[model samples]
Target: MPTIPSNIVVYNLITKRLFSTSTSKNMNYVEKVRLLDYWKIQDSSLQNEFPRSHLVLMVDRRLLVTKDTPDVKMVEHSYGDLKQLLGEYGLQFDLSNSCLLDALPADNDMIPLFGTSIEAADPPEDSPISKSDVLKQLGNSLGGRFTDIRMAMLTMQEERQRNLLAKFQTLTKWAATYRRCPKCAAALKMRTSKSGAECVTCQKVYYPTFSPVSITLITDPTNEHALLVRHRGSAGGVFTAVAGFAHSGESMAECARREIAEEVGIEVDLIQSLDMSQPWPMPDSSLMIAHVAIAKMDQKISVCPDELETAQWFSRQQVRQALETTLSDPQLKKLPRTLDDRQTLHYIPPAGAIAHQMIRRWVDGKIDFHNSRI
Candidate 1:
């Protein structure tokens, strides 16, 4: 999902590589992982070439993770090791519950990686080992704890590891939800490649996909201030850029323009795509496309009660201060009493989020809006 296919022949809006003119120098992009190359290997070839692959274990959307001082790591297990470990607890580890995630190169060999969900074991009534107890025992045995996917994504310091986690969560969710084909309601089997599922009855194929969303940070023509909005049910004082899903037959740039107009009742000009994006898997799978736009001279905002609670233009200095402030639990509580309040402090999305990166780049003058035009 990071890179578009070389032979991609699709909608005009998605055919291009989606290259952004402005790449931030301060951002550390994910490295050493090519999504297209990983999926290129056929399923049969992957199994024959690499019988023992690495497994990322998940239980109820929580990942098995361990902390190493300043860094966090996901626990990867070999096929035999995971099978034996799960067997000890009367659980199954096989293709029925696992999905192909990626193939990463290690030394001269390409190690296949899989995302697996551990289902609860059904014990007899007389058995003393409860499912919770078994899970606890498993965690203790692995010397790691099961952390929520969102928390793990936020805590992971390595970009490659974070991306892998996102991929695992997204793919597993896709597989779990689409077990039957829509055409005939027949059972679907996993495809050998990263392509997705195939229906046995009707010979239908379904590929794992993420919803495309455009997140735009609107700023004044002078670039002195940027606009942020608080959604209806978002956490206290958490304001983010205007964002909405890409409508069918519309390009991402068009989505940005329409979302800005609909969310804040203001038209924008000079829209520029940022050279960064993120695959968000929480709640659902989504590719967050980032953009920066300059609002027209008429800065008056009419808040959309349905989508946003309030929208306001914050000065660059104020936004920078908010970015620098540590948004701990205590800090968030004391920032602003209400969602619409214009207090001395404000809070934006945290690290790991595309919105945060976009806002940061703009504040640091990394997004060169001078050359960016419609």
Candidate 2:
């Protein structure tokens, strides 16, 4: 049987290989590695001498990728490479519009390639441009189709690159949205030492924000079946585990129980933390804390029309089969028609998603309810 790649392994490999080249005579390899782990270049002027080759250019929210098989091959370009590409496209690199995502180890010997967002000015507000329209414009500017960041994250093989891209996207969005202080309406300036903005008027600093969400796979008391739900607004015929954002003061477990009850009108007990989390960027930036809980009281489900379109309990055998079908083809697949016309063949969430991971764990008998507390 094949096994999924662990996120920890991918993360470590990315950090190690992101800048593995030998340093200059003045710098040792150990120092370079340490710098890579600890450094963040904040000075804009110092970026001039930074190597262009190591830079990851994010134009708008899309990264430059090759138009080839797998379709997730990202282009690793240096500053010179970027200049040439921009010249060919009749565009210029505007530093004022760019920001440092990460800096290199040595003082001015910055490897600016770590994280950078370089793009032309954004369209004015009230222009009402759709995402597809923006992507089309970017594709023209880059000489290749601009893939959505979410799609790239899903298909990309390099976990490190994917994570970096997500961070870049999040940072870019944060910078744009928090240009002014929320309290006093004062213009916020970027702090030179870290990824934060400070207000000149109120002395308030604004950093990137991430919301917490709870996603759970609920099983019957006997653990013989799992609950699956179809969201009213979900794309495709896909069903997923019950999920909801954690309220301002709610615990993750409390959020999980509340979400289950509110979405499907059922109570869940024995909520055991899966201790697995994933950064989800869609709709908003959030950390999804995955969990497994047992359905308490009756098995009957009363779906909340506003929250879910359908809710049903699938037996362990059915869930295992579903996972097998999903694993065989990572893309959405359609099964043969059944007598029940209302029940269509639906796909599960992609593998990288915490929801899918939780389901896979449950299907593999890796999740234990015996140790769970009420």
Candidate 3:
């Protein structure tokens, strides 16, 4: 039994989008230095100061799983170079095994991860390059540079998240513990990133935030209402926004139209994207893309008991009140959250999931709350 919705953990604090992990920005000190041509060749002197963090080794980067670790160092890399490794040791990146972690603290910017093999460097007992030195090196490597760094300070003037106490529980048998590479079936090596997961195996990558799929917010113009469907396994006949996966060669808006037709027998016209996002962790993983759509020129309503148990239209007020929040439609009814059941764990979306997030955006002005174009 997990307190977290499946693999998802409710954020302990409310801050920026990088709400879970501190974004890599406003470094009181962030610099870049040339990888001292020779230092790039050694390591005997490297293990202690920057000893490979076991946790970091297992997973490239981490999102403050325990809130606080007195001694934690942060690194930022907008652009990096493998040239030093190439020039110094004649070692090339196993391009097939490298990855980039770019977790967003906000909508546009993200933190990045840059890595190379520990086996490549020459051992040396000297101070590591300064952030500016490294920045300089990075600038030089990319045929340019920037030593000054800027970032969002909403974390400082407002409130720094209270670091929670640390606890460790081994989910050795948890299938979610491992991920699959899109290119190959091999197990993925989870690394830290400003974005999301890093796969060291196939080199194919994934971000904590990925693609978004959407649901149709269909309505009955005559009745001034919308429709919702109850899936068979939902909570106590708990009803929710109608949704499903988008097919290939489909747009978020288009997916919304299709899912509505298949699940509840409705073909919509005037469709528009509301918002796009990823599902929470507890129940499952999905990039929720939300859309609002209406019948082309007339009323439309039909049902397919095969895909859903019941599909009916609800007034705007019904949806607003049921959500508990302006934009949410909680899964008051849900299936067992088990580690072993594929449909239960893998197929299901995270509870209080991103699906709600997209809707929330719709409720707000971020998405066209009154329009039908995404």
**TM-scores, in order shown?**
0.79, 0.76, 0.42
Q: Report the number of the highest-lDDT candidate.
A: 1
lDDT of 2: 0.68
**What is the per-residue lDDT of model 1 for residues 1-374, given as tens digits with 9 covering 90 to 100?**
21335444342223112212212231122322333343333455455533467788987566888844456788888888887877776777666566676655544434568878876756678988886676677876766777778867765767778788878888777777888998899998776544578788886778888889899999998888888998877666677799888989998889999999898999887688886888888776888899988886566899788988788788899888878763453124455665346423367776767787888888898877766554
Model 3 worst lDDT window (10 residues): 161-170
Candidate lDDT (C-alpha), each: 0.72, 0.68, 0.38
What ranking emerges by TM-score with the best candidate at the front?
1, 2, 3
Candidate 2, pairs of clashing residues:
52-78, 52-79, 53-78, 54-113, 55-113
RMSD of each: 8.3, 9.2, 18.4
At residue 242, give the lDDT of candidate 2.
Answer: 95
Model 1: lDDT of residue 102: 66
How well is each residue in 1-374 modelled by candidate 2, as lDDT tens digits?
A: 01214664465455435445534445556656544443332243334434353555566666767665553656655677667766764566644445455444444343644445665455567769865676566555554566677767666666556666666677667776887899999888764323678788997877888789999999888887888998875644566899999998889999999999899999886688888887777768888899888885376799899888788888778877767767776755454344343244356766757777888888888888776554
Worst 10 residues of 2 by lDDT: 37-46
Residue 353, model 1: lDDT of 73
